[model samples]
Target: MANAKLNVLVAEVPEVIPLVQEAWRAHFALTFCTSLAEAETLLNKRFDVIVCGTHFAESKMFDLLRMAKSKPKSQAVPFLCIRVLDGELDGTAFQGISIATCALGAAGFVDLNRWRREYGFDQAREKLRQLVVSLAHQPT
Candidate 1:
């Protein structure tokens, strides 16, 4: 399974530390694209999962999920959305994003800021690894 890494498409990658970025490359074979059009070009192939950023706007999350799930090759791929936190954050936006992504059939959502704040870097990395481990084995 280590050698047979999962293929993943990451749309609109966020700014993170090198370790977090490296962890993703180490754990999965990632294809990154900045726009939906670019992502669409890459979607001709199957991916085990699609990780997307909301681009600091809630609607972009919906757009990302919609595009990925609409494609024939990527229709069933497990889709995960990464959330961006604001400086003066409350729990309101957090809950809203979760419910929305859930309603739209996202496999999961990762709040890296929350994970790092609550669980530390080591634990956050492990959790991401565990998540990819589960999705990698999912029936395509």
Candidate 2:
């Protein structure tokens, strides 16, 4: 039998779905949710990773990270939070949010603008690929 594709839970804004799907759907079995509440409902299910898009300093993405870390089934799953830049914020502000998210249990942070400009996730993609490969090789 063929191996199952890795499952990914994407909790991001609606407008960013196309970009995310183009990058992830081909490799993983993706389930998209536009809101934190919707993501919460699916927490009981299994996912290899959670990719979230941050909106502000205290965005719902952080809450999801905390909740996932607290859950037994999902606690080990990695959460990658992508910081979106609108050209209005400085690097300091973005760093602060990324730090806070990591403190709250996010596995890592990615700069969305950098990923877009690079036409891919760049370093973030490599990290995620490593994570997926590691997860796939683990015995159940």
Best by lDDT: 2
**Model 1 TM-score relative to the real fold:** 0.83
Model 2 agreement with the true structure over 13-100: per-residue lDDT tens digits: 7777886677667778889888777888888899888777785223687788888889888887877777664643457876887788
lDDT of 1 by residue, 1-140 (tens): 55887888777644532344677777777777766667778888778888777772333667868777787888888888775444423478778778888788788777777887889878977887788678757776
Instruction: Show the lowest summed lDDT stretch of 10 residues, model 2.
Output: 82-91
Q: Record all residue pairs in model 1 with backbone atoms less than 3 Å apart, i.e. clashing.
A: none
lDDT of each: 0.73, 0.73
Candidate of highest TM-score: 1
Measure candidate 1: CA RMSD: 2.8
Model 1: CA > 4 A from native: 14-20, 56-59, 84-89
TM-score of 2: 0.76
Residue 131 displacement in candidate 1 (angstroms) = 1.0
C-alpha positional error of residue 116 in candidate 1 after TM-score superposition, expressed in Å: 1.1
Residue 63's lDDT in candidate 2? 82
Residue 125 miss distance in model 1 (angstroms):
1.7
Clash pairs detected, candidate 2: none
